[model samples]
Target: MVWTLPEPMLAEPVNNPALPPGFAAEPKWDGYRALLARYADGRVVIRSRRGTDMTAAFPEITRAAASLPAGVEFAMDGELIVWEGGRVAFERLQGRLNRTAAGAAGMAAQWPAHYVAFDLLRRNGTDPDLTAQPYTARRTALEELFTDQALAPPWTLCPSTTDPTTAAEWLEWSAVGMEGLVLKNLRGTYRPATRAWRKYRVAHTADAIIGAVSRSLTDPATLLLGRYDPTGRLRYTGRSTVLPRPLATTLPARLSPAGEEHPWTGRTFSATWGAKAALTVVLVVPELVVEVRADVSRDSAGRWRHPVKPVRLRDDLAPADVPLFGDDTTTSLT
Candidate 1:
């Protein structure tokens, strides 16, 4: 019998993690969405959310899947994450996600990935088209599989609960790099490639210095933000998405350049932090500060994991008021 995996269930965006009653909430892991399967022929495959084969990219995961209890043919859906320092370390994880067999071994040993299964679609070659079944039933099946199989280490059952209170507690986890929460209707069926589930991420707000801009001081597109560390070195935190039209035009006029003492002077900036390509940018004096909406996860270098959203100009607050680190998540400024 030819074994095939079910399509991935995608999530719809929600402004907040509020779920209506009778729904279930799970931690929205900040990692790759993948499906793990074990075939009767002893073949193991780990596929990306887009259905691309990723077996060679994560040899360790394949080895774990192959070690599953013999005679167990199963397919599961979940997130593949690499945890470090008690948080989801996405930047470190990315180094392994796209690597070839030769480069993968090092990453696996350094930051081993964990497969957190959320749903069970197949067991013993049985169909039931778990997609057609309600979420509660599928969730039950997933729990049973974990219990019966005694799944260990690399194989983990994703933490889930129907209680909204418990999920609200998880929202606080964003500060330490937890991605927010995902909510699904108890009766909702898994719809492949459909946004049937809802995801509300934990957004963070903090202040950053305006180190650089997209264009010259005359007109700018986005703000390149930075923060001063304990050593007094200005490091790039992250960039904000394009500003509103008014700010993009008027703010450039207010920025002044640091003729000699500018931290970023003579320093080259990338179009993106990790990318090799450089960007043509007009560096500005780091006196002006602005508040930005950012994600909880940070790269190993202490930069925001994603481009932040510019909230407003903090003209009243001095640059010193801005926290040296962006992970200071307890502030109520928002």
Candidate 2:
């Protein structure tokens, strides 16, 4: 039976960790979502969430197909994670993401990726399409397959628990760069391209200077935040999600247009990381410090990998009170 990998199912953000009845929760690994398959004819494919072929970028993972018992074929939904300093390092994975096969091979030795499998899409290359099966059934088959094959290293079975107390404990893993918890209904089917699961991020509040805004100073739609480096340079850190109406109405009184001396006076900000679209922003005085809730996922430079949530204006705090750009003190919350 020939089978093809499908686009991965996605997760929606939830405000809290309380999962509904009959749901199972797993730690949300901070890494790229990828689908892997070992074909019945011995072909192996690794694909990104957007359907980009990533087999060449992760040779070790591709070679992991060899560990499967002869004639055993399977498809898995998982994250590709790399470790550094004894914790999952998302930046290490980014460095090798687009590398050439030879380039990736060299870097793999120092920062090899581990595939953390969360769902089994098919097994034994002969399936009634496991995606159509209930998640509990798929999960049981996945664990059994791992034990039967003695898989190791590049392959890891993601931990899942039906107990709410255990799931809540996993949220503290943010100190080691885990994003948070992903909860899936045990009876839910893996509908491709659908938000079949929900996520609860482990968040920490920190101070950031408002360097720019996406709209008028008085009614800004989004905030472009920054933190001072050791040299006192105001570095563009990350942006917040859209501001609520109340916050938008209250910010104008606190903002002032940037002067020539502003660090980002003429710098352009991308609408999103790696996006070609440029944001039309009004540079503002960087003296206004604000508190934001963000997850532990970050680049090597300590920039937030996901849009932060604006909590409130920190009128009592000064820009200097914020953590420095390279300081992990803010994100290293347990």
Candidate 3:
């Protein structure tokens, strides 16, 4: 029987990324979840999490697979990433996805991609299925495979640790694009698309001054948030996700209009760039501060990769207490 692309094993949230004595921790990379396999004839196939056949879409990666350790002619699981400028650039991957064979070669030279492998699923061209093997046994084989190959560029051996302390260290290293941490039970067996494996995603929190409100000030949908620079300029940081009804209803009474001195007095704010969904704001006094939960992927202008959600009303926080990024957390969430 021919081997098919098995569903990637999934992760459930745990408060901590650390594992028990028999478990192990691996750095969760911020990139596409990919399953890769190579043939006896040096042909390779790649598949995305959604099951898209990407063999022709990543020619360079196929070539690199051909160069993997001898006798490693089989299927494996890994994360495909574009590492650049000392960090994994998720945005850079857009250039390589959905491209033809001709286009892939050009993009490969411009923004090369690498596979950070951590799991072994099959050996020798789809024979000897390793899915039923204990994680400990399979992990041992995975490491030995990398050592045998003297793995280099476009083929990275993912770092794994049995020490919780080391996992905590990687969680705080999101500045370099560490997605989070993955914890696997040593005795667990590989079960595709299952939550037998646990994952802890990194989330950061900061205070945002509520500088503006949505169209329905009396019961607004979202809050326009900003932070002050060293020069005390209230620059637009980003917007918040929908506010709870109770909070939204009471916001109008607390906000006062900015007559003329507002920095965003005449500026337009779009919820998303090039997106038809635009929002107009009524600049208010930048007096109220709210706590927001966000991820590390930020825009060139320092806004978050996505709209942040308000953690809660921050009556204890002041504008001075609002931080401007540069904080790391070890906490994990689903």
Candidate 4:
């Protein structure tokens, strides 16, 4: 017997160009990629992104799925996210994914996963065949099926808006750790593994003080500049391409070798730029401040993307007062 499943949804990397006019935009949620399956016998299965059976991993989801109105076999697509402390803790989900039966019971009591159902692919004995239906039609069916409370932990319908300006506003004030806005054609059908949809992302940045410099493991002359947050905590952002050009000769004298080894240096060198070059070693006291831009989004580790671009030095400002954008205040999971 052939089991019905929803067409796989496609995702584009964040921080790209804008979509064409008249596209509907939705918030890119942070959670495990999930495919909800319901058999005619009222059995449900939640599959993970890697095709692992997560039905047993999330008992609450199973219980909830069983409670949904019967006489139907359906498949839904969405993310399994645990909302906590006003943020989506991806690490919490990861912990739950690897738990044993006993461990899952304990973790369930601590952190519960919320199934955010966004699309419906099959309904009852009818093959919705959503690939041929426009997004509006598919979304309407999803809203109708989830209108009742038979499903457990409740499911949130991913809201879609047509206003690009409003969508842009959402991207700007995205405290929920949104990757970006996904724009779908109102009349377009779902296409698996296709880039028919467009994604627009807002990049975030901050001005930080360069606390020190580290030598590049590849390029002897290149220097990796280290910056500090407002709280005086040091973090490596990226290397300075311009710094080596100006102070190439004087770098050796001003540099201080790091005592402890850095984890990033040992890894296979992958360059954001074209060529692979030797790393540099240099350390400076916390003195210089620079503006940096980066694509800020949560990874599987529940941490925002790091090592944004170092824009330029802030000559008029003090290193102690450089502002940090999108700190702990902005979150959507709570």
Estimate every model's Cα lDDT from 0 to 1. 0.81, 0.86, 0.78, 0.62
lDDT of 3 by residue, 215-261 (tens): 76566788888887767788887788888777776777888877788
What root-mean-square deviation over C-alphas does model 1 reach?
2.0
Return the TM-score for each candidate structure. Answer: 0.93, 0.86, 0.79, 0.72
Give, for candidate 1, the lowest lDDT window spanning 10 residues.
Answer: 325-334
What tens-digit string does per-residue lDDT give for candidate 2 at 76-137?
99999988877787878765666787899987877889999999998874354798899999
Per TM-score, what order, best first? 1, 2, 3, 4
Compared with the true structure, model 3 gives a TM-score of 0.79
What are the clashing pairs of model 1? none
Candidate 4: C-alpha RMSD to true structure equals: 6.5
Candidate whose TM-score is highest: 1
* Per-candidate clash tally: 0, 1, 0, 15
TM-score of 2: 0.86
Ranking by lDDT: 2, 1, 3, 4
Error of 4 at 171 (Å): 2.0
- Report lDDT (Cα) of residue 233, candidate 3: 82
Better of 1 and 3 by TM-score: 1
What's the lDDT for residue 317 in model 2?
A: 88
